[model samples]
Target: MTGSSRRDFLRDSAVIGAASLLAPATMVASTTSDGAPDVPGATAATTGLTPHPGPLHEVAQDEAYWKKVADQYRVTNAVTNLEAGYWGLMSQPVLAKYHEHIDRMNRENSYFARREFPALWRSARERVAQFVGAKPSEIALSRGATEALQALISQYNKVGAGDTVMYADLDYNAMQWAMNGLAKSVGAKVATLDIPEPATHANILEAYTRALDANPRTKLLLLTHCNNKTGLLLPVKDVATLARSRGVDVVVDAAHSFGQIPLSMDALGADFVGINLHKWIGAPVGAGAMYIREGRLDAIDLAHADESAPPTRIDSRLHTGTVNFATMMTIPDAIDFQQSIGIPQKGARLRFLRDRWVKAVRDVPGVDVLTPDDADLAGAITSFRLHGRGTSQANAAIARTLLEEFGLFTFQRNGIAKGDCVRVTPTLYNTPADADKLASAIKTIAARG
Candidate 1:
């Protein structure tokens, strides 16, 4: 499609609230007669795709084997990227499918959007819902995790005049902002506290217990399945059960965890949740989903209930007026790719890479790994600090030095409360060698200190 035609479709689609204009695009998840999984519009090469290739426990540790998988991404070698938590780059297979969608969208233009885009969007949403374990009716598409989370927090209507809302330091920063704003919107009190420094299951649970006990009127709790800053995975299901027993509702921010690890509404036991398809799911950026347990939609008010669609409609809850149609269309392709590789393999590889780096640097003099020792409490993301380098500036300096002098790229994060630290996140594209390089660079930096 030409630049002008793209603009026309965006304009026309937004006006119609129409997602696509194809010929009743009917993408289904039907298997072949031989029982092989068949995904529509995913004609990308299937050479590396495998649902099960022996035990993933062994495959996850096979660096050479994963290196071949890493070759599928067009990763830059100019700098060792340890910041994959921000957003994931699509694999070549998924990227190819994305380009095909882009080209198709351009070709069909308004003709496609007006005629068949709705069904195509449904197929995408349905597939995403299936991947995340929810009915299509319970899911709504959003720009990303932030938008879905903000909408969930802002629309939370269960709060009475003096009810309280609470969040912890581990929650995403923007999500904290939304929770804080609840005080004004619901005329509710806002409670905030920090998670334990040397995070332990007992201490983490104790922190929430103290906050909720102190605030008897706590009606809503914001929980992060996996924190962005430090990569701490909270006890979401346990916390949700505790809150529900106390007459408190929970809204889970699963932006980083949903795709990184296996997730399902039944597994999380949350009434409301917002997750990103772009983060660990490997879809192109600008894709996310929101969930409100089917029977409990009345707890949150809709954004454009009366103005656009009714509050009863889940999609109307978030106003995705115009979006990257190609990106949205590519979610099924990404899901297919992820399923083929297997979530267990994907997560195990991430944990393997994380352990590779942490195990190496944990003993370095003046080097402190901030993430917890419990394997279950963390994922691919981890953080560390120089013994005396507790200030944000010091951590930033270490990160900058690693990037400039050692040719390693890393980023700094605050809210550790114990100390500012540098975070390292490895993706599927990363290899064990990358982890060794990061570990070596950190040791060198620590020795120089």
Candidate 2:
């Protein structure tokens, strides 16, 4: 592939990232051939709630209206779901669009895969990159954050014999595997540490300071912007700057942050990162992205090559096998749904839900909430252990009790080095009533103890 072919591939692929085909919140549009007005609409197609025109945080406070918004999903009456930290189920409107894309894929098959799928995949990549203030050339599509993480961590080349690579116990388990593998590939030493229990913003930074200071030869650091196990939000920008000053390159795992928290590439200050669109962006199960800052591309090798995609191109690093054409094509609907709701509002709603539940049971004897008080150090995702029980079986049993006794579907997060706990994450769809029910379940369990 020549330079023109590369440009064509990029140009064609860039169009698929549309959050919605209806209109855009950020882009100015030109009139159609029929002279129709090109302004964006305020109303969400699924929920019918026109996001109130004002500061996003203020709009987030209107719960009466947000309840109506939750009605947009084909949710169940089975249980009050508090496990939204994983895949964010699609809204009915988005699901309808997704089904349509699936039908189109089935109908078109090879024709679409050959001529249209690559561009759609690129579009999905571009939209994800745009949401984070990145360039199309710097983004790659993946099945989920795990694959993106493996590519970035495994391919990291700056570390050499005796140089150290550092990561915390809270980092995603799959990424931990990649970092451990990196030790063999680059002949680098692995330095692992733990986040202090009952972590505060200052204490979290202090922990990183000690780790970097103790490992003077550490050249690569793996930072989890938000960890899956505890849902603890680390001060990545501060830590990344700290690492930079120590001459260490940082790779971030933001698998749980992008849509649940307000951020951009510049906000986190990481040169390389892997993000999950499926988690908070509400894309389908297999959608996620990887980002490599332009100047830092050479720090990691491509997992696979595109004769057409240059080494500097981020997508070149993602040697994703035969792509899921249907799943990739429907990503725009998720992006559109997120944009319709407003990112700031989505973040505020999640944090609001988290606080409501954690506050409800925080002071209860024998109940412990693991999230920090500082807003920056926590968000919608929070975890807790009963009687400080940290074993995998203990946490799993607690989750089972929540379900069997109280009809609450929550998660048992078992990977924290400090201990195990149950993670409860509330999304835009969850109501305050849902939070109250979860709190009541915790109280009931604690009262028995």
Candidate 3:
């Protein structure tokens, strides 16, 4: 098909699908009291029954119910967004709250920054702590996960010549870059363990344990809860427990796992944990967080604190100077939205969407599924490589064709040396029909080649 013709086809198809998807929710008039939808059983009962009267099992599969949740997000009109792992598009409620925060901050000016900002930040921190099952004092707000990771890494006072830091090949590039720079400046060794495709919990834990055993000087171990590319879920709690027993502190990069799965930072037993709210929480871009154990707070250098500042104040070190309050304010809203729907239900829905898409293409002649099919080993994100196609060539061709020809937006996972794959991430807003479209597109592309 010609480019224009392809665009037209996608446009027409999306319009029909979008309308059908949104009609149920749009038809329900908003009640003025809380501005929440006036659905049946809108209020929770005394028995703590969920407002929606249905079996928990049935609620997750209800197409109209999920569409109502999806309608909250004002996504781009031109494409089916499957790239939420990189950055989540904000929902209408969050965006509206964020704008109100911006206007309030602007109106109050320096007064807000000096007087009101501290209180607001504390509230945000408390909400985040509750959301992730950590102590409020233990959490520190950061611009994003990268900054949080950097803040944790910058704490070591002595690393010259003999010390080493270990991380897996699946770690995020930004964290990898920071580790490399630290190695150069401190003369510390950087070691990486190669993780296999479709890795199991046992395999991943064994690789890290072996790496730590080999490198006696390994002072800190960094691991991601889920890889951005492969979407492979690591046994973080087990790894942390093992590493701690070996006298090594563990820092978890939870950018991909935080909102995508159920998490409790304290329960995981990691020395440090960092996550990006923009990806899974559906918060405004630029919102993220870091957690440090209370007693261990004094170990890290304060990146923005003055010499006179208290050594034990974790937030002081991480929350220095002026910040975007509007973005920060949206964190709670996102958290509430997620909580209202319930984490387990949301997770199941996401997994269902992922499995539906993966199953459709798994047997295709040239496709190699990189993510584990087991639900425990995966959630939301899934990757697959096309046989006989190199990373750059396949990723470029597929990504271009999907957007230009099919109106699907996805992340190209070609740069990683391991294998080439296209990553598809479906959020609460995504429907089974969306999965069908993706499967059809991938099948078409594979057949053409």
Candidate 4:
């Protein structure tokens, strides 16, 4: 499609809101009986677009470049979407790859699954390992972070009777549950604490120190690198080192941090970690991987003692029966798409989008921005609570009002120690104008109260 034609389509989409136009002009409609659309934007092989040659932060400020980046995704005009925490949308290139893999899997069936898929699966694991700076033997793919985390938590054999497994209030809900179950199964105790509000690096460290001192028997610490609750970025390395000093093993949850920020197993200094490729990596849903630092495999028991793989191999720790093969195969495409834009550039742009709205609403009357302004502590996902409204019902209603009244989509998050709040997460497809609209919407909502 011509550039002018594409512009016209997008312009008309604002009024029409047709489902068909949701796919950008760059997208190729499906022509096959199976109805798989062609890959959009630049194909994985040809996506050599450098985005911008300037410094990373300068590249983030280049709106024209970001607009081009935004065109790579298919976005709907139905509402301004600010909730990207659930799962990421695959770019056209990645989606096309997924469809291709799906079609191949269906056509070849057992021939591909038994003979060919094993090698491809190994390559996918290697790709994920390289992405996270780990060895192939240390990485094992799972359906999502939750699966990997559950395996890690449930299989943890360190804590015995009278010992303790600890998790914070800000950790993912499933991980917390797994910790509780692990403690119960091992005849251990569960230790819980709340992450401090207005969390700064020093204060957060202090909080963990206090928690560790209070629960000396805490043998396992479930530390979230980037919290799902309010997008609070934790200093994992520091916390992990402290835990180690106290003879505690740390199981880091990098589910939300994997592709959104710079992540490396070495940097995190955690022996066990779980990450999701589908969240910020732009891979299809059901793509995640777990990391067990070399020599720590014995800490986690083999999945049901099935003896499928060697006990030394990390895959032995997970026994996911049958996974979405197509989703796993498309991970390389998603990684390539993200790399084409560069991680530093992507992280900066997301924080820029976050700052655009937050700076506008931070001081607005009755509006409480939950995330700290420090770049080290915050990212694209930030939650806010209207003053005097802390209940789950109130926060959910605020989210509903945003969508119903302002056509802005967001999510209400509970389990925050202080109170429930509405989370706002802006993705790659969102523009500065969308952030402004969110700021305006929140201000209007606050005025109503």
Candidate 5:
């Protein structure tokens, strides 16, 4: 497509990515109106708890209040979607801001990107740093959590030939792959372990402790604050403390945990971490950040030996040549929307939706719920295996059956030691009714077997 045609096509679409929407550097800037006004009454005072009467736990059960929050998203009722773990739908307010940035970027082209974007980029990074309780010098923007993490793992300079690197079965698949590749490149050994079935505070800690004790030569350990496959929230602070005593440095993948839960760099107790802006914070696609604690930059080598920024700055850690400029600019709007609703309150509601279905089928004869009911252990994402059905094909059939027979959508996940499971993740757009529908569908399917 011609450049003008491509820009027009992107402008009409609901979700826009980084394409050639800009003109040549010498092109004169065109004056265009910013697309639309922000979402009405989307201020902090009206979003999260200001209008609710009781505390957060009580507010979670308040269906009327939640319905209002749900209206902010343009979700379809064609199917009861429970696969929000993949990525989040940008709220109307954030979406509007995104479109506005898109128009401005397209109109001004390279002129805006070259001269104006640097300051705006720094400001956006600062906002993310402030929201996550880290310093601006410690945060660097990336395409997503996976990009940031892969760079951190591959470029990590501490591992030696005889050392060991380790991860668990429940960790993200891409991250696990990165660990393996890192070990291979450095001639280091890879140690893999399983997160205990029926995971709880005590048993989970014991499993990690046992693995660490068994592998004394371990130098770098990877931790996922929230497991993507099972939504198992790890006790990172405790595990990081344990690893530190053994001289093992920890790198955390907080992709799903940062905005889904009440999280901060301080709470995680890990100096190196990667987070996603698009997942729970509701930013546009192609937005994420990495954190490297002050004085720890030397441990993570510069990306591709990039000298674009000084070695002391966090931006030197990775190089993403060209990115969605508009997406980066909308970071503050997404952060604002999330903060207006409050992370603690959002997490409580998500857990409430998760519990709504899990509680109903937990004791059923053929069903096995993988995530614990402990609010501290899991959030919106939960997975289950039916009648010990965990093979790739069996779980795929289960997921297909749910979609075809019950009009419910869920995803099948594999990697846990016990077996494969179908993951159900509810977001702000989902309601109590959707969770109940899922419960009924699962009960019927399990009964027929």
Candidate 6:
């Protein structure tokens, strides 16, 4: 937080805004236009293949391979970044391309803005729509998931006085704050249900079903496809089906789930879905998207923004004014990078690393695993608490000691019934060795008492 200057924030915001506006095709075009050689191992044809039996996993683990990927980033060696869930460091290709976009916009000025920005942004939306399995008209690019959810909730017409909006206690705090504010302003009621630790598909389904049943006036149900704190993956399809049966619209907060897992908005059956590309997709920060189902778009009002020719231009509504074309443009690169790794392979590797760490410390005498062990119920992230130390003191001590002693970075969440725990997340870039390092650090910390 100390090094973050206001000028730096404004510059990054501009880059991210531009990137969010331009579509994948335009990113490709802009890259080609700038004469920065094509991304190694990526081509239009190579972007659409499934993983085959081969050496990709071995390649993924190689230090040289990751170093080459890491070279794309401008990160310092000051800390081991285990906190990618909050924000992923940008890769070299994206960073370079982002600067290229900035230069282009600055060079061409109004000509590029008037002639090319619109077409490029439209193409980006179309590509994003295709990636998420939604129609182009249905997708809206947002600064982040918070804005998407805020827009949807603020614009939703049905939320009022007697209406109820149900969400879980484990959901992200920002959206919860927004929901609380909306409840106060619109005279709506907000109800929160407790999600059990070590959850199952049935446990989650039943909890939500009971919450909905208990609140007959519930008009909307908000659920995170993956809980930010515990990293518990909810049974979204099951919840969506049940919510639909009860005449409630399901707005899914998929901020952490979208690119982390293989996702298709159509198959999930949610009425609305919001995701952050900056997280798992590895797009630069300030990039997020929203999916409003066809025919259901009219149900929600649009937040105030400058309009284009068409009333249903969802991207125009979400992205307004002079925006950063660079960050949005890199979405295609990020998607291409993820696609090259293959979702299933990446997911398998993430799970393997997560399990390795969980198994190592799960049985420690004073340790308790807070997330569900079932793979279907979670991925990448796992949380736990020290038994005797409880929440506050345990979390503080662990956080301080880990950074001081082992150079391990982690997140802390307190006040849950299961006690305070550290959340360790492993991404595709992480190695089995990283997991071992984390496991060793946790064990050492636990032994101190």
Query: Best by TM-score, which number?
Result: 4
Tens-digit per-residue lDDT, 1-449, candidate 2:
34344344444454344343333344332333332222223213434445556666666678776765676665677888889887898766566667777888899976766566666666676677778899987788788889888888888888899999999989888888898898987678899999999898788899999999999999889999999888899999999999999999999999998888779999999999998988888878998888899888888886654544566566567777666777877777787778777777888788888888889998999999988868888888899999878899988999999899888999988778779889998887788888999998899888877
Tens-digit lDDT string for candidate 6 (253-273): 988887777778966789788
Tens digit of per-residue lDDT, candidate 3, span 1-449: 23333223222132222111001122323433433333331211111212244664576678877866776655666799888788886655556566677788889876655445555566677788888888887888888898898878766444567789888777888788777777777889898888866588788778887898999888778888888878888878888888888788888899877778777886567878888888888888888888887788766677654332345667545643456777776677677656667777777788888988899998999877788887678999988777756567768778889889999988787545586678889897788999999999989888886
TM-score winner between 4 and 6, please give it. Answer: 4
**Lowest-scoring 10 consecutive residues by lDDT in candidate 1?**
20-29
**Model 4 lDDT per residue over 312-425, tens place:** 667668877766778877887788778878778889999999999999999999999989999889988999999858899999999999999999999999898899999999
| Per-model CA lDDT versus the true structure | 0.80, 0.80, 0.73, 0.84, 0.84, 0.70
User: Model 6 — TM-score against the truth?
Assistant: 0.84
Inter-residue clash pairs, candidate 1: 20-113, 20-117, 21-112, 21-113, 21-114, 22-112
RMSD of 4: 10.7
What shift in Å separates residue 105 of candidate 5 from its native position after superposition? 0.2
User: Which 10 consecutive residues of model 5 have the lowest summed lDDT?
Assistant: 23-32
Model 4 error, position 295 (Å): 0.6
Model 6 weakest lDDT span, ten residues long: 1-10
Residue pairs with colliding backbones in model 2 are 16-123, 17-123, 19-336, 390-420
Off by over 4 Å in 2: 1-47, 54-58, 304-308
Clashes of 1: 6
Total backbone clashes of model 5? Answer: 0
lDDT of 1: 0.80
- Pairwise lDDT winner, candidates 3 and 5: 5
Residue by residue across 137-240, what tens digits does model 5's lDDT show?
A: 89988999999999999999999899999999988899999999999998999998999889998898899999999999999999999988999999999999
